[model samples]
Target: MSKLLEINNLCVDYVSPNGIARAVNNVSISIAEGETLGIAGESGCGKSTLAFAISRLHKAPALISEGEILYKGQDVLKMNDKALREFRWNEVSVVFQSAMNSLNPVITIGEQLTDVMLAHKKVTPKQAYEKAAELLQTVGIHPDRLSAFPHQLSGGMRQRVVIAVALALEPKLIIMDEPTTALDVVVEREILNELYDLKAKFGFSILFISHDLSLMGEIADRIGVMYAGNMIELGEAKTVFSEPQHPYTQGLISSFPTIHGPKERLYGIPGNPVNLLQIPQGCNFQARCSHCFEPCTEHEPVLKTIAPEHHVSCHLV
Candidate 1:
């Protein structure tokens, strides 16, 4: 379980005319080889920003203000154009949130998949197309669909195509940013099951990003909870889900209904998420937290280890 990717003191900011918004603030985490690490948080919590930063895909207005992203001991931030080009897809691939937007509407699925291979690897057109068809089959899509356009396929099938594209180069780490968010529950389940099987077969690590904690519990070996650009809790999936430490983490878990447990009133965290541009001092969850004390309002808590492989950031902890 060697460290495949390590992010240290990462800080991402969005600079605009109005002000700078700290999208990811001093967040640090690591993913082991062949492991699946899930990041759970609501929208605007910087989960997607972190994923984009990992791949150096953050465009204008988005800047990496601080920190290091090390992939197998190499600094991703310092990579030159040529090195970065080789690093993406070859070493890492990203499955974006939307399948429809990710793919080219006009380009045939076969061409899109082959184009990725052709761009990265030294392969003949015939060979690239052959690999493309094989990849489609691997993701449970028929090879015949390769000749079809993106709109010609179902939502689930389009998603499978996106997954196939990510696997085109057999990358060591795949950053899945809400890969199944667009599909129906049944389709989502089927795709996730296939994704799990693919991870086992390929032995590739995954950085799974989603707002769904229950889904994260099912697919992730470990879970990291983020709030207002900060990581509040991180631990084994089972431990974090069953015994969440941070008040925010607890609120997120309690908001979801459980099937096995006796029916109980669902509780939602009060107050809205903090504004990143004008974040207040101390804990970001202080405004929404029912357990907020004086210490929670005055001082920001750093991630403190409470148990083996479990860390929490809160004055109460």
Candidate 2:
């Protein structure tokens, strides 16, 4: 398939009180049409920051220091405010965490959805309302409930409403950050199933971000493991799960419970993620990585192809 999005050497920085903090440091990844790519990492590992940079959502404190986020062969970093405003929801959309809160409390669900359509589609409010009703039905919600308030909907229902809003413009790619983290396991599974079905039907790509490796393994076509703003590993989902080359990735997998098995103990990665302002001299994960060698503490490893479509950034790999 043809590539739809390509992020090249993307680095996002922040001017904190102490010093410069590299939130996303020299990361790159791409997505083909209709593909699903999962980005897995702990909080502060730069996963969400990357999303912000890609969508041009970074603010004053958080800035894209260097890199180009290309979508559909156009340089996203170079887009003007007018272009960006149009590019945002029309081509690429984001369904943020706890997206239930994205709805305006004062406005009815119908009005909120209509607002998005009216802005992007340049349609009349009446036309926008009809479109919103269609979108609610598409996401398995009742069109009659369009007049309900945001607080009136259940958490799962609210999430579906967000998903429905995300599809209002039928974006080619959707960046979903912890989309199901706030829901129960059963509800989470149902939402994921619905997403899978929608992906199959719409042929839209997704940049799925989460710390839940196990859950991501179920929905992603490929997986990229990040550690302290660096992409430590990338490969086919089965290959990554079966034989993780990066020690950090292996450690992350060990931290998750397996399905269809007795309750085996899960181990957490030791030590906390490195602070970007005071980043270590070598591999950022070297301190917490049990398989680390002396060389790991002195030199940062560059990404190397370990197999067909698999890349790892570990000296020991």
Candidate 3:
């Protein structure tokens, strides 16, 4: 596959009373065309911050302090306002964690979808409606419900509608921030299954951010684990699942339960996520990592390839 998005030592900072908060610190990752890459970590781990930075969605308080976000060889940080407006919806879209709330309660679902298409695609009402209906159908919702209000739909239905609106522009890339966080397990499974089918049909790439490593391993072609604004590991999903090299990755894997397997004590990595405003000197995960040695506490390790396509950022690895 070809590289669709390449991020090089990307850093994001927020201006606060205490000074700068390093939300994303020297992070580098890539997603290929037609690939599904998963970003796994707990809340406040900078996973969503990475996604927002990729799309240039961060506000004034937050700034891209360093590095480049390259989309198809073009620097995303340099796109002009008009180009960014065109780039956002048509080329890259986002299905946010609370995206269901993005649906306007007062407007009919069809109108909301139509507005997006009209703004981005220069389409007429009829054409936009046709496309909207097709999008709704793709997510297994009835086309007629496009005329209904948001409250008229169930939580799952509303979320699916939000997804329909996201696919309205037929974007080449999408950033999904815990898209199934609000759904039940059954509904989450269904949505993920639908997402997989959609990826096959549309041939689009996804940068999926979530705390659920197990669910991500089930669908993502590649997985990257993040901790305290740093990427600790990156590799094929199966490889990371079977033999996670980084101690942080191993601890994360052990935290989840597996069906049809003998139960073991799940040791949630000790200590809270490192505060960006006051990060530790060395490795961010050093406080929680069990295999931390002297070098781990004194020096930060760069990501090194352990196995084929498996990168781990740890002294032991």
- Model 1 clash tally, residue pairs: 0
Each prediction's TM-score against the native? 0.98, 0.97, 0.97
Task: Give the poorly placed runs of model 3, Cα more than 4 Å off.
Answer: none
Tens digits of lDDT, candidate 1, 1-317: 89999999999999999899999999999999999999999889999999999999999799999999999999999999999988896999999888547799999999999999998899999999999999999999989989999989999999999999999999999999999998899999999999988999999999999999988988999999999999999999999988999999999999888757789898888879988877888888888888889998889999999999999999998
Task: State how far residue 269 of model 1 sits from its true place (Å).
Answer: 1.1
The numbered model that scores best in TM-score is: 1
Q: Please provide, for model 2 over 1-317, each residue's C-alpha lDDT reduced to its tens digit, 9 standing for 90 to 100.
A: 99999999988898878989888888989999999999999988888888888899878899888888888999998999988988897998999877888888989899889988987897888888998998898788899999999999999999999999998998999999999999999999988998988888888999999999999888999999998888989999989999998888888998999886579889888899887888888788888888888988999899899898999999997
What global local distance difference test value does model 3 have? 0.89
Stretches of candidate 2 above 4 Å error? Answer: 261-263
The predicted structure with the larger lDDT, 1 or 2, is 1
Ranked by TM-score, top first: 1, 3, 2
Write one digit per residue (lDDT tens) for candidate 3, span 130-239.
99988999998999998899999988999999888889899999899999999999999999899989999999999999999998889899999998888989999999
